[model samples]
Target chain A: MGPSLSIAGLEVRDPRGRVLLSVPALDVPSGALVGVEGPSGAGKSTLLFALAGLVAARGHVRWGAQDILALGSERRAAFRRETIGMIFQDFLLFEELSAADNAALSALFHPRKARAGLRARARENLTRLGLSGTGARNVTSFSGGERQRVAIARAMASNAPVLLADEPTASLDRAAADRLIDDLVTFVRRTGTTLIAVSHDPRLIARMDRVLRITDGTVSGDTTPNTAEGAQ
Target chain B: MMAVWNALPALWQDIVVMLLLLAPSVVLGGVVLRGFAPWPLVRAILWRFRGASVLFVALIAISVGMGIGLLAQERGLRQGTAQAADKFDLVIAAPGSEITVMMASVFLQPSDMALLDGVTYNEIANAPNVAVAAPLAFGDSYGAAPVIGTTAAFASYLAEGHITGRMWATSSEALAGTLVPLDIGDSFTPAHGHGDGADAGAHGGAQLTITGRLAPTGTPWDRAILVPVETVWEVHGLANGHAPERGAQIGPPFDPAYFPGTPAVVVRSDALWANYALRSDFTRDRETMAFFPGAVLAQLYQVLGNIREIMSLLVLVTQMLVTAAVLLGLFILSRLFRRQIALLRALGAPARFVFAVVWSFGAALLLAGAVLGLGTGIGAASVLSRVVSARTDIVITAPLGWAELHFLAGFISVTLILSLVPAVMVLRQPVVPSLRS
Candidate 1:
């Protein structure tokens, strides 16, 4: 399956009673690393949320021609579990749980796998993210850089094709941010998955296949393919 | 059942006794055990405490209520029965068959009654001990009122020791029992039993004066009339009534007509004598009957003991139900906490291991509540028995023994063990949505 995303005349309002974001139409193909950039309150986050079917929007969000909004909350939660990978801005890690458990927790939410199989996949992902021997340590004890890596591991652990991350590296130092970006791009390319990331960081913006700029409820500009491999 | 409701005042007495026993343990245990629970679990425990679990307090209350009620009932009956026995220390009549039961019955006096040890007046008075001895020559009745001739002591003794009232001191003075509360200044007319004011004509109607009124003692004394004991001898012309002819003891007479008198009913006087005399001086006759208050009460208890045993058994059954209730509540709470457990579940914990953690928490609480409840019940029982002993002579002080305590502990263990049912079910349940939510 060529995991693709489509948004048509989608409108998301700021919960603070303001017009936050709008898109006439947009589509991104599989294996594409897309960068979304905008100033604060320019609704880059809302646009990402609208595309991922996380927020209520006026028009349509579809994944491979299936209307995402048409699913009920429970079914939508299941759909999000099985096919959507989210790297939330707050990390939204269960604070009481361990880092490896956070990854496993998300995997267990998918209603499709046997318990043992889900646990093995969770352990494998944590190991792949360099979180080996840290499965039982509380996530709160993990350093911000380590926590960021754990969040990425959780987002990708379930092998969901469409990865939507709010801010990939807003807190990372330049060197670490570069390395994390390289790692995320390599993972997306290896899995042949679509990546939609919202960030204000220039280094991350420069590493994408395409860049779309958002300003005050409008798509202000689009930079044609200078994709993940441009650095290669 | 209406009697049970009517006994609420007594129930209050029981609750006061129970409070003296159980409140200390409940307050202390609740605080200590609550500290061990997680914050959310503590909140849920408090909520349960405020809900149907309040029935525990009611159980203690009902036990105390019924206990106090039974105590009061026994006390009242003893007082009433003793007063009736004191009215006639001696009932002198013609020596005949059926004498003992005749003495017990309110009716049937012999034809030739004579002056006895005690006196009588026309009416009863409170101070029967101070009254002069009179003789009885007649036993007749008009309209449910008995007519007897005896010394002024008849009036005093019949009063049964009321706070006020004087005994008849003169031959002409008289007193009435229930018949005439208003005739204190009236005269007696023995010549006529019934007439339309005709007996009032003789010798200024015998000039009978009522000296005192008797007090209400719920005894047969409130129903007789009194005259000097000599008056009976005078009417019978048996002026030598005081001579100890057959088997009687002599005592002073109230009138010159019978200057000295022998105790007429020797056996009846002996019965009264036995109660007050030294053990060595006690004597018995062929028609003797001794009423032992303690023995009578024991017999009454024997009749009702089986029912009390059954009631206590029922109480035990109820305690078991309460144990079951605790188990049920804890089981539900464990199931509700499964989301927290699922967090642990996803952390690579085996299913059986996750179940053990939840079960341990529930078992601890059930054990605590059961031990506390049982300890409270026993402590209350001891204190209550002591209070009863101090206030009244009825002794009912039996503490719950080791058997009861062991049963209580076992009940707690079982209750807590059973409380883990829901936790086991939760472990086997799917963890998909728990992980997601």
Candidate 2:
């Protein structure tokens, strides 16, 4: 299959003269669990931010044939809503909302998307993440692991074509992290959607279809994932 | 209207009424619903602005409510005063201000104005088109009510107010109004003068008989004690320690100047032209002040109306300024919520999401305040009317009509429209910078 994502000559710089991120060329296949790994201050998150159109960057970030970065701000936001799901390191779940509402809020902007439909999908996502029947509780009542699952549920509930999860399991224990990796791989395989995850854990990175590392503001060539971990 | 009135949850109807009044403006916002929906974002943001919303609604209620209440009370006061005078066709007193005499006779307020001579009474009665005339003698009180000394004809002019027993046939008898707490054959001694000790019983053993009680007319007459002029003369003689009878009897060659120095005289006429002519004649006389009571009432309303108009303008301006300040504060508070707005925007919400969040907050505050104020103002006015009736005989009957509705509409419209300013400002703000910060 053709690459689900294509990047070309993308570069990001701070207002000062320092370059923060650079990628010459890259392509990611659909349904691939691509992992990004980097040391502290290596511009890993910056590169992810640029790919998500959350930061100003030079050059092209195309989803298939469409250059999403070249789209107008409004259209880009709409495209992001419809196509790209984001899971941040800190878990950007809305604290004021119940877990269900936090997840359902993502789909509300879609035309003809009824509240009932969104909540049903959100409930399905929450249940898949081992958060069954916890939809009505406020997110503040949830544990850190529970909150992370809620964030994942919010990202996945909208059924966006791509998910950019930065350090998706950073705050999780080994067992919870392993479970999340297993769940994410299963979700990707079923939906045939692109999953680009950044993690410091070798166990998480090792399960990816392909892995890319950021070193000295530049991305390294891809490495094959541990087939044993993927199979498990 | 009945359906709206049924919701008795303290000012809820006022809020609903205010919203209904502002429906056209709110409906204008319906156009935005086609391409965008921001209610989710609106609901969340309002949660954060809960305290500000309370403050906003409270301000609106006081400003708008007080405005409405004052206008209503003034209208009632004006109408009640006017209706009180509507009974008497013309009031004749010793030459002075016509309104002063009308106020003294119909309103029962004691004044220092000169009293009409018995000659003036005779002249008023004999005037063209004059059907009946009755002399009025004041300066006496009986238990928080005025003792008005007039002939039997005075009761006829006070519409719908008739005696049950009889119209005080002898000088010692009296007729009390419905509010006076006296019935047939109830005898109470007269008080000395018009002061607080109305039951001081200072008159020299002049026990007055309540021959009958008058029915309620919803006017100052509902609070009076009617007696013949002879009873008052007898009471005055008892107070001053003089002879019992005011003799100058009723026959030909008898003196018409029997009750000289009587405080007032009321007349009724058949033809409008004759009444006008008599009024003109008496008004020109150096001896008497003639009042077409309606004209005097009109003058009173004109003065009060002008004052009320000024007060209304002041209230309107104050409300506008307060609303503007509230909006300005809202705009500033919204800036504090910029991070939230940016977060919503980042969540792929449209600019309308931010706008709706801010606008809904502002609108809710103003609407709540306006409604609360409306109920408070109306309730306060009603209470004040009763207090005034109990303490002084002046009755206020404030009207609620198109004018009040118009004021309410204007209030809601202005507030909603002003809220848009803050909404627009929030909508136009750069989303990315706020998120980053």
The prediction achieving the highest DockQ against the true structure is: 2
lDDT of 2 by residue, B385-433 (tens): 7886676665666656445666878787778887889989988777545
What TM-score does model 1 score on chain A? 0.89
What RMSD does model 2 have?
5.9
In model 1, chain B matches the true chain B with a TM-score of: 0.38
Give one digit per residue, the lDDT tens place, for model 2 in A118-177.
Answer: 668789988887889899899889877788888777776667778888788888888877
DockQ of each: 0.03, 0.38
lDDT per residue as tens, model 1, B1-437: 67865677965645544554444444434532332223333333344344433454344334433333333333333433433444544333223333332332322232333322323221112122323322343443333334455544444545545524566665555556643444566555454333343243333324456666666544443554555554444443455334435213222423333344432321222243443331122223432232333334445556666766686667666656655555566556555555555543333233444554555455445544554555555555556655643333223444554334444444444444455576667676554344334
Collision pairs in model 2 = B57-B369, B61-B369, B61-B370, B61-B373, B65-B373, B76-B397, B76-B398
Compute the DockQ of candidate 2: 0.38
Q: For candidate 1 chain A, which ten residues in a row score worst on lDDT?
A: A106-115
Candidate 2 has a TM-score of: 0.85
